[model samples]
Target: MKKQILTTLVFLGIIIPAITAQTTSENPYADSYIYWDYLAAYKSGQATVAFNNIDAMLQTYPPQKEIAMPRELALVSLDQLLHDTDNDQTETFYTFINTRMMRVLKDLDRPVEKGLRIYKLYNDGFIIKSKKATVAIDLIPGGSNAKPFIKDSIIYGIAGKCDALFISHWHADHANLNIAKSFAARGKRVIAPKGLWENVDPMIQPLTEHIETDIKFDDLDLTLHVLPGHQGDVLNNINVVEFHGEGTVAQTGDQWGTDDLKWIDHVNEKYDIDVLMPNCWINNMKRHLVGFGPKMIITGHENELGEHSIDHREAYWMTIKKMELLSDLNMPYVLMTWGEWYDYQR
Candidate 1:
């Protein structure tokens, strides 16, 4: 009887803790509730329920790695569901995007310090705020489809907070006409390379110029150095923004460094890049960083939903492995997801 009671006590102890761990919010797997809920909703053809699940997951603010891994897997699974011919439930996919966009917009409205704070938006989109100005780059909705996921009101709210919009290229995933229109409506600066919105609207023409010239934003107390670059066969602009008191930041929008290192070599010589924002999939990244020599690096273009191909749909694990390879480069790099911000001091 003593041994029987002892064995029963041991079994109860293990079972109770296991059950608690599964149900408790403090458990690391608590976020998985959101993930599984979303999947169930997707399978049931309940778009609204799936979106609510995503919102709940985002609200939980799970540990960065936990959130990143499961969120990406869920997104990939969602993309497949949306593309499935038998599954006519595509509305949830858009809901998923717009809901997250609203969250990002709300986060942007938060009060920031006079020092530099960078927020990672969709894909390569980033919002850089400093004492003198709030600058937005590549601010657009994600997904391979051209349809806008974020509403006009949300775009207006984001534009109202920004002083300038710097588009890296003419790609749909990296550029938004509605966003640019909002900035222009406020009489703010919208800088880009030539051929952006050339056919869409006359008023939307970006302040295009040669890559070497420095464009000044007097109101923001900032200067932008547009460098000539390329994304595949299309013209891509590598923007190096210099804040009044803060150091400079460089963002390469999908640039592959195929232009014989012309712009990379030039920028390396001309400026001291405080933060280098590059695509996670850029080839020969070590060589490019070694040449430009940024003090710190923050990789972007992870898990671009717009690309239907999984090869282009990057994951956090891939970024970690890539960073490990470039660890020998001796540069500190950070990986950030949507609506996340990084504060940098000069």
Candidate 2:
């Protein structure tokens, strides 16, 4: 009887904990071990491992409110880890690109059957797909650093699905020569302002056109209205793309306040924008959104790792603050990390 009781106790101890663990694993936020493990891995400079923890936490796809605390904490941890320049810069860069950015690339490989699907790559980089055509705007890897985090093959794979590429400006973080070349090589249209790659490579020069001109690609059933805009004093092309029968989207690449409002107001008056994708840190973001009056706002360019200054290093919390300030505007806005997407329907 003593032996039997001991055996039963041992079985209960092992089996009960195993069941608990399995349940906790499915719901990572409830699993303190997983959270702490991720924090420890991140603090120890194990970016890959830390990112796995983030992935595990996000796998359940908890509601934004439910995941808010963990997500912010995770981003804060990553921001701190990346700022430790004493660590291996190359390793850190690759770790971010491989884990976060690569996940976005992988997600983009899926098909968009109906409606408009927007995938945030990095910074202002996005891939907007519809039943009509796949449009890639400002599709870049990560940053302008000498060491490339994302490979050319990855760019090619994304370009394979895109029917057109729209470059917002000549900034290294917003525009990639190799990515543009890949799209062109694939026999897709590459549209940008003149002098994008004037000195870099002659072969990669894009088809420049007037900013106010509407470039229509009937084959793809797409129409792009390239609006003349600027980021500070530098010329920036704000693209408004119409995916027929689905919806319309406007991507503002670092395009700042009132300087371009004349054209922005005109565009908004002319087109009913379903979604507006803008840099989260832009000056007077509320004013810009109000002028455009989009159905939805999705802000980007948070935590651009390429930037050297911590001030420019945006965080998820900053985005939250911006969203709060704009809360009274009576419009819905979404803040998505890399690899995340939002669907818009007409």
Candidate 3:
């Protein structure tokens, strides 16, 4: 009798609540909402208050893959508020995102004792730091048509912390002119493929298309081995960099050419790589994985994108699906959103 009573209590208190939250999420406009109050506050111009409520809810719900209820809804709601809004509210939405990112940027000042600490800011923008040096790859302020997405002060702050920046290609989403200029102005090395911003920013050095040369810096304690790549016809430099004697970390910036795979499929045979940050939608990801052979994969290029089309914007759940389908490979991976960090050990 006591066992039956206890089981009933668990069903009502735990299982029912989870099921209810899941059901409520399917109809976002339903009055039986988990986050309607916060969403209302944000739309009504109390963004700070809305943010506080959302933050608190995040703490309460926490985050998990399957069991966690309403966390996914909350994230989706916030993403919708940011992306689905109009030009009138652009500044407010931008402010909300930048505020969160400011906290992340400040946190980078704290030292990491071992391995690599990688921080993700919007889209494919990442800053990877080690005990010896900090390297930024595909660090954009946002897309060209929609930028000043991050404040100059924030971009400058990023430049202040990093020793160098490596841009992959000429696309504005990946190769931000202002971000590269900020790094270059600090007398820090900025390298990209040839013909990117040619004659415009003389300080932006172009990497030659040869694999033999290892790009090194005078004051920076790091080396970059290049893999000349392409996104269709666009030249992309896949950066395989080693910092502070740590494990190899490779950054693939929009590499999607079949011809590029001839070399990419052989990355593991060439060198031992610890971390590989690949775009979530890259072609033949399994083939790319075997080639790079990183200990773990932290995916990028989700949700936030350049174009106005909602279809162009990839969601975080897509990464989750990719991971599940690729479970056979036994490669460990973590899906990350904006302002998230993953510490990887060699």
What would the per-residue lDDT of candidate 3 be over residues 134-185, giving only the tens digit for each residue?
Answer: 8888887774534567776776787678888888888777887777888778
Off by over 4 Å in 2: 1-49, 62-69, 82-93, 144-146, 198-210
Every candidate's lDDT = 0.71, 0.72, 0.73
lDDT of 3 at 259: 83
Relative to the unseen true structure, what is the C-alpha lDDT of residue 234 in candidate 1, on a scale of 0 to 100?
75
Model 1 alpha-carbon drift over 4 Å, by segment:
1-96, 143-147, 199-209
Which pairs clash inside model 3? 303-314
Q: What is every candidate's alpha-carbon RMSD to the true fold?
A: 10.0, 10.0, 11.2
For model 2, residues 1-346, the per-residue Cα lDDT tens digits are 9999999999998898667655553435433434433443434446556656665554445224223676667665656655555343556456655565556567766777888888877767888988768898988866443666565566567667788888888888888777877776767777776667654444344446535868788988879888878887777888889888888898988887576776565566788899998888777887788878898888788777755576776776777777887789978876676667777776
lDDT of 1 by residue, 127-155 (tens): 89887788999987554335555656775
Taking the candidates one at a time, how many backbone clashes does each contain?
Answer: 2, 0, 1
Number of backbone clashes in candidate 1: 2
lDDT of 3: 0.73
Consecutive 10-residue window with the lowest summed lDDT within model 2: 58-67
